[model samples]
Target: MKRATSIVALALAALISVYALFLRPKENSIPSPSPELLAAARPLDTYDFDLVLHPDSNQLGVTMHACFQNRWSETLPDIVLRTWAGAYASPETSPAASDELYNRCYPNGFSEGGFVLHDVTINEQRVTPTFDDAAHTVLRLPVTNFEPGQWCEVSLRMVLTVPDCLHRFGRSQGVWLLGNCLPILSVYEQGAWRTDAYAAIGDPFVSAVANYNLTLSLPERYTPFTSGIFEHANGLYTTTLHAVREAALLVYEQSVTASIQADGTRIVCIGRNKQQAHKPLQIAKEVLKYYNQTYGAYPYPVLMVAAVPFAFAGMEYPGMIWVGENLYGQGLDDALELTVAHEIAHQWFYALVGSDQFRHPWQDEALCEHAMLHYVRARHGAGAYDALARLRIAAPMQENIREGITPGSPIDSFHDLEEYTTVVYGRGAAMLQALDVHTNGRVDDFLKEYVRRHAFALASRQDFEITLADVLKEDMRELLIDYLDTSM
Candidate 1:
């Protein structure tokens, strides 16, 4: 009887153990957190990261995964890359055009003159021992060499010296500016250094940032107005930036002007010489409000508008943008307003959302411009918008896009800037606009959604377009196809 009882007990224990093994599940089954290194800085004035910037310089940190070095040779020959920077050995056949000569040719290197890089941090990365030879203050790095799903931070300490840049552009760098002219980690994808779409005639398109914190040290004489309010401040004179979608800084050293917009979203007519800027400021205000109401928050903490002399009409940079000629000084014509609105709108389109500008130009510029055409149409009633769209979009849509189109052609090939500009700036925009129009203007909604989804995230035209298709109906797929495939 005792042996039988023991056997029963053993059977019961075995059964209970089997049940526990199956039901309890495995422990430590959860995976570890992915590797992510955020770039932290003092909200605005407080730089929490490791950037010990020079007190009086115009250079800003490009906080990213790039380590400045000489590794660019891995993708292209040193000479080939050098020509892009204006150090050309061959003149006519140079990938860079003559107009682009000075931008890349810092023969004396970063320290040659204006806003130069003073220091760099080497944390857990290898770099060239000496950046002595024509070092464009470069930290050559395989920014994407680490784990595929990781991120890194880098920052620049830039000083504001518009006159110097103006000297280069004939006129000063304008109040609405967008161009990358500092040393940086060239974007690496598919194992090659990413070049700008117009590498044949212009400079490279530096990658956009995930997050940026700008600290401007301006004189107390100038009213410090940025995208977001001053999060913290030393006193009335200096302040820290809170959080912003995307912003550019504008400092009017010419006057002790001070007037804040009613929305408090901008500095308003703050410059002492604000008269020339009034009408345009009104346009900027109206357009900005329209964008905020329709699209999404503007990117960055400030929209720095510096009136520089004009070589080209205008340009863009990070945290700060420039429009050639003081917007105050210019007459606010529809054409002028359109340019201003277009550049301002870029605050959200290109600045906030990320893309591979090198491989696909239309992904951002064309898209943003396209969105602007719609923006004008929406804000000023369709009639006004329709007329503007006629010369830019409607006509472009009527063209044969595929036949005469070359993948890479010189800008001069077109009869006018309008024709070439349309393909890139006009038609590219029309394609998306037409797509939006087809999807019951759903593309516009998707564009805003795309910006919100990709806020500070990298994507390709294919990435956005595909994701867009997901949001669109099954019937809407043809719209995207026609725009991509059709020339007219």
Candidate 2:
């Protein structure tokens, strides 16, 4: 009788264990958290861009209405538009026309690309728009008697001649990389318009956050990767985005793999084939998750990654990033990973916490590179990160330091691409790392608090210093004078 009772107990235990191992339902590894809700900052500028792409002619017929409200105490009398494409007028006129970066857009030459402003209207009245040919990038319109707290609408009809290459704003290999193709309103900074010329060096763009409602009409065969909520219907695609410095679109004929992040963000990866898209899709997902966890939750609903055949490794827009197809093939896994991670970091640094790229590119570039280092360490382990730092950051920075170059120089202060890349990205990251050491690993906390405080706001060097000081409970400006030059 005792043996039978023991046998019955053992049988029951075995059945329960078997059910737990094989038959019971499994729970999700990473449970979805409640969505983080935050209000968007009120946009001071809004743009309504209607563009039609003529792929065969490599041209865009555009009608843009830009509305501006006075963010200042004083009334605004005039507005300036940056016709960036005009910089590609001709090699003889534009110094950067035949440069490598410019040629990336105009592979053949500048003859294929330029901007032509046809008409301008202010408050439903016809007006003349001044196009500066020598500068090749300014369009000024007078807004007389425009009062404070009043909205002024400036309408422009223009033709954008897309070049036959790939850089920022051109066509490359049957795909159109439409970045900075539209007439961007110059940011009013330090009580004046920021009309920086299109330099051959760094990204010569400076703009304030603006709301965009862009409608694109193109062929059905193309899938457009845009920097906003892309809605396609009736052979037209429209996108609406808020608090973005610039809007971008990449129209391509490729396959896209879509996935949903744990935070309910839509991620689309476009590439020539499924295999090409799969790896990047996976990388982007991991990076996205890590960033959302580290910084604030990404505000936008969709994030698009398009692999375009371009020269540059990657370019970050507001909600979309163009990953160069060159990073797809062999012997470039590290480059691919670092590039994707860096661009994703820009979602937080450049997109959410806006910085003056023209004046202090280091604020974003260095910080993004540092964040990428953290991602590499988290994903691949410490040894991999150490190797990456040594290869990408340490060596170049060592060379730059030996050359007596300051890490916090302006965009145009550097002589060439190599110096700029080394000083800004490498040494700038090194400075951040030094700060981490000085703060006893409080850099993570400091950065998170910084993002929370300055989300969707333009952050200057002073703002960064003040935020850091607040975090440390002491002034950090003098301590980090070597890193952030206030003189600039």
Candidate 3:
């Protein structure tokens, strides 16, 4: 009897060991970040979110607990948050309401969508939040006697009505995009809060990096592709993203996936089927390899690319990117490759090296375009690079110059998407190309140094100029003025 009991105990111990080693969650197996990266991410704000998606009702219920420290020298009064999804509540406020976007965004006509705030608490004390705009996109919460270096905890409960549209923050065909839907803390700079309106042109967003802990519950059939490494267990999906401007998720009913590793970073591509996902996955792997060699290593552990019903060619997030679903069809091979390369470049330019994309759209957009040129030169040869430069950059830029349109103009300065793309993407890239010529093709080296200096910090126009001057050992004020200050 004693021997039989000992044998049963031994079998139970082995079964427990097997489960711990092999059947445990995948997130537990993820490698830890470098000590330097961890130290840089420790001081920023942190958000804990519990999200429940009701696909049948087209709504998302969220409970958020945000802890943020006042980093400024002097701080009092209130904290502000940007409820970007409110911009979709009506046609007048929607960025996609423009004539060029309305039809593409709302194939089934307009559907109202916005956040319905239920309650708010600061340090466990109940408080009421106020809306600073008619659209209710800017929310302010009054805090009592908050001081610098002191941390504040905010809790919120809200429900978001997902719009039926093809744009970001909406549902289209069986896929739902939850981009910029959460109420994110607003930027406070130079002794005041930056309450920039949601402009109808360009990507009108400016934010600082924050750590995110998110748990999402979706319907049984739904699968989510999110911004960070995630694991599934007991019908719940959990994710953790460190040092990202925002967390984005794309939920779909079904997907065919492909994955590859480039320089220790895993790249996953998801589409409706294998035919649509394989090519982009290969392109993403190639681009990641090139950028890692050219600039620096990608900061994140995993990068996800998903085919979405987006109006644009692609959209960039911290650890994820959305490729347009339409581009998956045949005869659009060039478009697909270019889009993948450009968005991957954003991982370096926009994600790792932070900037105010709203105020200085050229900072990231133009740099990505410039990086794309180098990628073309390396992968497709010098002849292909030259042809692409002439067709995409030089021609459109010349036209913008002829029209007296400045590439350095803010998003509000442009009347429509066409003009904004022509100036910011085309002409702005031309300015960088000119810099490459002036520096004897040393712009790549300059950018590598820039990324090293500003990784995980926000950079300004002045900062960029100073970094370039330091890299080249000569002042570039005159050349920058020629392109940024004057149209000619």
Candidate 4:
């Protein structure tokens, strides 16, 4: 009887070991960041950036004094910074390549090259930069001399030669849409630096919320739209922005500004809208009102919408948005209005509640698409929402069904932009819509609580799932597995 009891106990222990080793999810297998690191970097990362734009020479002169606090327990090591401009020079190119129909960025061919860096320094001392092209779009900076919990101040000067193309970091048609032109710190995760490259599809960036103080010098006649508020002084314009991703600057010629007061938030529309200049600002005002009431208040004092012919239909920054000229060229129709709302929705999902856009893009892109649907339902009638659902969600999802793709897959999984749009954006939104139906309108409560829970900080998929389960008072594992294809 004793021997039989001992045999049973050994079998049980062996079974437990097998489950722990092989059956555990990958997310659970990865180690969590140290609590001491989290506590040390308690509040925010900050940057003091100075940039000068010379449109005639197509050059940008930048000097950044970035102070980043180490967010890991392991001390006396190096840090990684991403030079996203190099992705343009790489063979894979930008996200526009995966775009099937629209070829606005490289119309004439891929002739233009990328950016250049010079005068790198660490803590007022010069250091040689090491390139790691294969690992990620990054440059390694040695910080082995510094201790843990220390704020390392690294300064570097760089020059970006803007190509003659309408890209995220190019100038075309007298408009400059400069995105990811700055070398910012890479996100640290799971006791390692996330050094993923800019991919051919999806916005391949993972970042932390940081404050920015910018001083931009530009030509006298050109009006520049920036991610932060500006005040012109002594031949240079200085802007102070807080709690956001990297800064972006868009310069335009023959542009005008219109202002609207929505709940004491100043909304500004910049640049020419050949179709209807006032329409962009009008949509911005209305969308702002609805989102402010539903989700949360637009925390920024000012929001600028610049009507420019950009590579993408619309792009969102912290306090500014870029409205494509393609939508405006055809007039202020449904497409233009919704695109504005979609970008504005990013303010809540992306700018406010940050996520790993590279690894878990569905966190923001998918959520923004669904949030746009909510806006359509609130502003327009049910009919308008149905139409949008058919055009944006239903149609795109049909293609994914034919392609055998799932919505919750990571951004790196998709090869084409259409598939990304169909699966990640469209199907993900559909999943949310279905969840709202399944939960009987309780999804709104979950989202409102989500915003309140993760405002001004980064939240992972697990964080979101835990919050949902807490709200529902039940296990949401089956629902997430079925919809998001998640194992966590």
Candidate 5:
């Protein structure tokens, strides 16, 4: 009897060990719901933003609530606001300078990319606003000399114009949506501030306060899609927005498909009125469902995608994707679906959780690329994504390419076609694949945790690495960096 009892005890011990090894969360980890599940719950913070479109003036009245944190460096120059001049010129061929031509579509003396002061309490003597031209940004203003860590409701109103009709300027000239309309604070990471990689401008850092509510009034013929909730609408195209989490508004052509999903998510798109965009529409619905099933439900409960022509090859706007003629021009089969999927991936990587587009491009952008590839793999078969990843690794990096090596090389520097191809886009795609291999399938859970922990906070590269290490194993450090930093 004693021997029999001993045998049963050993069996139970073995089973318990195996279960723990496979199912346990990390050390000191917070007990929380899975991302797939947590997404169904309410978010901790909410923000409200409004964009009053002015097609006649060729500008947008950009207003934002919530708040901001100022951390501009002393050395950078004051950001030049307004329409970008010759922004489409090739980065390699164009002169190394930044200048914007004001279209004067909106009211003047609104403080061109600079700080402005409205009426406050005279006796209150609100904190005086300050701007250092040398830093290229507004430092910090007390506003009301309020207590530290106190939430003060502040609003910034500005006017922005589209530069050109073909690219980014299309948002101004064409009937479409405009993203990143308001200027906030820049991220101060790794000892200095982070700049934007796409525009060669300063980084606007405010990831924590992404929650926002926005309302836009538009033509009856033009339907508007925004980031936050849509409370009610009146004539002339109106929507009341709330929970301003990130800064973005999606504008789409009145045509296309518009409907309320069963999950309470509003899915809209602007594509071929005929059958060309049908598959993309179907694929889009599936992608959204799959995203909720695999990771988490979209907290906003509303996602809008507009198919439109953009300056860049493809641009990811907050609520919609400015699908370019180049994309649909490629035809609406695989290429179009791939492009759409990539943009949808951004809704999570770039939209929900903000990243410093100016610096640390890999942190969120690469992750989005990886996430996109995962979906591509699912739709086309895993082998396809794996093969594409292999092609990326095969393309070697050019150490000689001017200044991809500086401490912040490629971080804040604007990479045009040539530079963007090798580093930001192609290499980033490859690195994600490599990271997948490094995690040994452990990334599934890590990503689930990552978006959960830093969903609405400023996350840095170091923070990502450390979190990854903690979630999996400290030993993964060398493995992850080896694949990400090096050619192999």
Candidate 6:
């Protein structure tokens, strides 16, 4: 009897070990946020998505559930969403169709891709949504009475075809880039929804702060780099993002990754190999540390920098940034470091303090460019900062002023990417530099105060001017007019 009992106990122990080895779920690699952070996020809108990837068909099946509250004073007539992926459905309307971006975006030539809405539901009842524009980027859902302070739930079933291109929202070199692919709630201001067109010139996305819960399933070999803290269980990956403007994910077969801690925030870098990953990881760590000390503490818990097949130097989302794969190659060390610093600055300028990128593209872009100067000054020296300022900002602005392009002009006012970058990024930074001189180099203090005031809210051009004036305790109208409004 004793022998038999021991045998049964040993068998049970073996079964438990097997379960631990194969059946038990993997723990979260990232640490949980503080309770205060979690509590602060509870009041924002919530988005939940269940996504499945089909590599064979180059498709993704998505089911989205979102809850939004009417925080506005007046009642709303309908809900508007920006279906940005729909812009890829036709070459005629696609942003990649431009002569400058065509070859670089579609390396193997363009293949058809876009969102196909299967069904939609509002308040648990089936509803029809209207495509309000030619590109089908703006979707409107009618409601009888969306009263103020009322909450609404929206559900959508859709499929996305991954385009065979090297762009941010396409597939390249067996990797899938999912930047701004989700249909998100449109920003409503002044008694109307912002239904901006998907322009090719600059980053045209503008959104409010929200929380996201994403559940993703992919093929056995593929892994996803997401813009949130995530864990894996039962063949599914779940992510949680708090108070972010948008979420981005990059899917690939494999990657070399490294992580470092910066003021309690986990900074992860992903690349095709160790050589590609290590340098960027170190650069990100330094940049984040500098920004935290200079401006304020980073709000999010995790920040990821992933190398992707993209034409641009880098693209910024809420918690994740995509660094162009080419920038990781040999002899581009300065470019890689500068790009990393620029994108990391966006975490404060764009992610933490929201802005209308479509209308005032300079707000975030120019701030980020100037932040790069600060980082250079702190890390290298004042001489390095001045050289970068002269080469990147002063020279470019002089040439752009020749064309009479105002740095604060609307995105549509620029005809192409060159003009857009020259004015918005170059001259815009020049404007801030001028302000720095006028205020006796108090721009850093002003930025710190600005972030404190508009941490998770959208700030318009007027808000920016007001904040600067308040910080300096002086009138800035003439200075702003000379730099931003009047060209040269």
TM-score of each: 0.63, 0.88, 0.93, 0.86, 0.69, 0.93
Candidate 4 lDDT score relative to the true structure:
0.76
Task: Write candidate 5's Cα lDDT for 376-426 as tens digits.
Answer: 777778788777666543453433345433212345454444454456655
Which is the better candidate, 1 or 3, if ranked by TM-score?
Answer: 3
lDDT of 2 by residue, 93-210 (tens): 4434535455554566555578777879988888877765575687888888877688888898988887665667677667787887788888886677787777766777777777
> Whole-model Cα lDDT per candidate?
0.46, 0.77, 0.87, 0.76, 0.50, 0.88
Find the 10 residues in a row with the least total lDDT in model 5.
105-114
Tens-place lDDT per residue, model 4, 1-488, is 99999999999999999989786434212222234323423477778888898888888888889888876777747788988777666435554444562266777665354667788888888888888875235888877556667888899988877766666777777888888778889887777777786776777877787778888899898877686457777988887666777788888866777777677667778776433356688889999998888787776767888888776788888878888887876555888888899899888888878888877788898888888888899889899999989987788755625334576666788877777887788878877888788888787778778888887778988888988888878777787677677321
Residue 218 in model 1: lDDT: 40
- Regions more than 4 Å wrong, model 4: 1-42, 90-102, 134-136, 273-276, 400-404, 486-488
Q: Which RMSD does model 2 reach against the true structure?
A: 6.2
Q: Which stretches of candidate 1 lie over 4 Å from their true place?
A: 1-121, 124-138, 141-179, 192-203, 210-253, 256-264, 267-272, 299-306, 317-320, 326-332, 397-419, 475-482, 485-488
CA shift of 382, model 2, Å: 1.6
Total colliding residue pairs, candidate 5: 35
Q: Which ten residues in a row have the lowest lDDT in candidate 6?
A: 23-32
Shift of residue 10 alpha carbon in model 1, Å:
92
